[model samples]
Target chain A: MSEKYCIGADVGGTTIKLAVISTEGEIVKKWEIPTDTSERGKHITRDINITIDNTLEELNLHKSSILGIGAGAPGFVDSSTGYINEAINIGWKHFDFGVELKQLTGLNVWVDNDANLAALGENWLGAGRGVKNLIAVTLGTGVGGGIIANGEILNGANGTAGEIGHVTVKTTGGAPCNCGRSGCLETETSATAIVRKAKEAIVKEPHSALSSIKEITAKDVFVTAKQGDIAAQQILSDVTETLGLALANLTVAVNPNKIVLGGGVSQAGDQLLQPLKDAYSKHCLPRAAEACVFELAELGNDAGVIGGASLVKQYSNEQ
Target chain B: MSEKYCIGADVGGTTIKLAVISTEGEIVKKWEIPTDTSERGKHITRDINITIDNTLEELNLHKSSILGIGAGAPGFVDSSTGYINEAINIGWKHFDFGVELKQLTGLNVWVDNDANLAALGENWLGAGRGVKNLIAVTLGTGVGGGIIANGEILNGANGTAGEIGHVTVKTTGGAPCNCGRSGCLETETSATAIVRKAKEAIVKEPHSALSSIKEITAKDVFVTAKQGDIAAQQILSDVTETLGLALANLTVAVNPNKIVLGGGVSQAGDQLLQPLKDAYSKHCLPRAAEACVFELAELGNDAGVIGGASLVKQYSNEQ
Candidate 1:
């Protein structure tokens, strides 16, 4: 009971999720606040500090009770130095993010990329809980991934170790991606990619249910495919195959214990997972395929905060 | 002089390279013996044991003067158990390799995939030395890669970590690889792939210099390209671009401090490296690219033995 807690903050473009987490990896309390976009994100840290202070006072906790603060931000973060190179939505560039937060709250601060933290969070307490090595793929607007090896986040030399979305599935020809690459896995597997594929498929097969939807969504594609729409089914099949090839290729390189699929598109569950696994098995080396299991990410939106807490916990242990 | 030494062995399809390596990683003495295939690889460990004993006796050293034996073999190796799932060249399937060696020599034996050890060797003392993380790619008959993270080999769930050649680069149509996949990085980057590309180009452009050579080799392609052969140059360009994209994709996943290019094709020197780097820079996220350097593998053929010795050194430290 006398043990200390740390604050886990997941900073997104629109909102910041925060949690009071026990050193033992449990979330004690959680809340969120709108991100302060005014002044180009200069007030964001100050707002975070105010929230932390108010929360401590409300819980009748002493300053000493909080060990540190860990924040997961959407950018290239130098985790060792807590520097964020760039985050367009939050308007941060070349900012010493950790220092600003520490200056406001007088508490230790740690920062890492949001996706990397999500991987860590999933490895720590989600579906990949017991696995020492895993790759967590988030399939939303963009395909994002985090790699965990030896139960630690793999931040590579430039803290971009787990950019799975950028793994090129097709080199000669495919859709262009935001990452300035063509044929990236993200261009095929992201929610955006799914909707695009559905829209394209509707044009090719006008009689398909997807043609009726004016604004085709990722969910609409999956739901239509489930209803036996040939166009939707074909789109899902193509995306799943792309996802499989990406995962299989990653498996060949890293050979993790598990591949955890997350993000908005992943909620399609068995419909998405079964085909992906089958394709992975087909593409992967038999030995690597036999041992690795593919599973849905369990943490969902909470991965960032939990992963932030895990980062703080790791740093505390190191200290 | 009183310090002990360990034996390092690199088992291959034709011959087994062996070295009496100092605990500090220097090759004290080295030699090789033809791989015994008559008894279905039953005598491999025995030959290794005899070689070690004879060398120790010739040096007037006692058994206590040696630490242990480390061996690197081609296959899916269970480093923890020293069991090889399959090594086609050695005819080993579900073989308990370490136990057989240990029973003969009464010394601890450690075995891992040959490429993985080569990566360890390079990471420990070759071009990747002083770097904590690296991915060593060998562009030989088939592309082989080893991933080193936190100064140790990353053995994935099935001990198949660092299998970079299998990374799929083309999804729709490409050359079929031996690993039951089409459009693998190996299909473009391997020395075999390079020769194949050149030969196909020669057939298409019959007047090109490549048509004169009866047995078009990878070195021939590089040399002819260097001599202003446009056909050969074009082939190299295509291959390097493919290599660059593949390496760039991998860099996005692991972000190692160094990417060490090894094997026969890498000997092409700047002709291979410069274009590869350019392609990598083009495909990679700028942040990851900034922190990673590409270098040629310095160890060459010696990498296997050295890496085996490194494994034993690592085990000794762990003990």
Candidate 2:
């Protein structure tokens, strides 16, 4: 018999990444397609189905061999029902994502928050592999988080569990966040926030290495800090300290075995992890800190799609 | 076969509250025994067993009529193993509670953090009854938190899943907590903290009604505040605001449907809940705040023992 397969779709603002994974959790084929936001992302499900059909045919596989599809979207997703309350980045709102995708693909489809899928993907084969309790933090334009407790995604009431970005880090005099709160963890640790802090620092230290860059990025700040620029080092310290404190507090609450750092800012690697660990140790309940380890996400951009596959494989096996 | 019953023991610093609960969730008998902390609490298990034996014989019940024992302990208890790493209040450290109790009673045993059990108890029959996702916060000598996700206790990797007391509310210049951290939620929101704040306020407002008292307690602060004492009112506002913010941050991470307020400090009822709810709504992510409600814990001191019974009933059904 041909090996059973599943499709994983990661719907993003600009593009949608899809993968065909074997039942054994290996990616057999992977590709991407442009996300058409016209008409409020209504075409997204149909487009994904078309691409899956084309990809399956290209692999010379029959539709019967496919187990199901798992989708991850950037929005408040009621994963139990595959309904997305809103995906502002994709211009979609109150859409029945899972049902529409299932109708188009003629297979069972599971949907989850993109960050949650990334955490699951990482747990399946990435940094948090085999760990029942984990916290996944993605440091991109904004900080995103997904928590896995007892080996399942913590989809709280209304499915907003693991909204770590919005956790207030600063009780007073904190920078404002897009979530209508001030001093969220995201405000101090997101890539954008890091760059903003660096830009502000450069204005004060015009002779610093960061001042030479046309537009200072979070990466540039890391590189400059590595070169021993005091200003850049201070910025790095501030971001990591804030992040570490937040993660430490979160650890006290969830007590995860591992914390996987992902996305663009985490690419700074140990530059971000070392100081962050120091601050976390200083702030965390010692026992929790000792039991939890920090690791950089191994899957990179494929985490969401891989997590999607994990979602499909998990639910498919249950049936 | 006779109706099965389970023993629930809430091991506190001074007393061990035990109950015989039917498999169907009814309390058949309830009582308490002073905790003998001699020999570093080693006598606790034996004492609990002897009382259970006495109770069963008095009720003319056979051993076959019993299911198992569920115990709740203070401090860092590894729920999965029933090992009390340290219950400082009770003089216990590195004690294998579950195994010892099981050996003595010859019945299955489960153990968890006292706060977590209170949450289970609340979810089972109190304010959070039937709520699959809930957060139970006990405001007492110290703050205690328990999170229930999808109807199960969220015992994290090391059993600190609901250590909401350690969650940092003041990131800087905050009072120190016993857990070797500064600005922990416990530092600002505990019963002790309330009394401490009230004492400090009364120092300046010596003409206030609170100044007339020989000793001030958390309850006194609430009552005085209700009677329009400026010093007490300020103290209540400060404590509730800090508590509300910590709870709001916790809610962002767990997103429980109901937040149950328990312990002695919560006895203030609306005086605590109203201002706390207002502060929570002001700080929590709007959607999460909108979805969640605050309720007073109904079982009072009985919550922990009731929660223990719930634990036995849950695991018995699973088997």
Which candidate achieves the best DockQ against the true structure?
A: 2
For B107-162, candidate 2 gives per-residue lDDT tens digits of 88999989999999999889999998899999999999999987889988888888
What is the Å distance of residue A307 in model 2 from its true position? Answer: 0.5
Off by over 4 Å in 2: none
Model 2, span A98-126: residue lDDT tens: 99989888999999999999999999989
lDDT of prediction 1: 0.86
Evaluate every candidate with DockQ and list the scores.
0.68, 0.73
Candidate 1: misplaced stretches above 4 Å?
A170-176, A199-208, B1-4, B60-65, B172-176
lDDT of 1 at A229: 87
lDDT, residue B248, candidate 2: 88
Per-residue lDDT of A91 in model 2:
89
lDDT of each: 0.86, 0.90
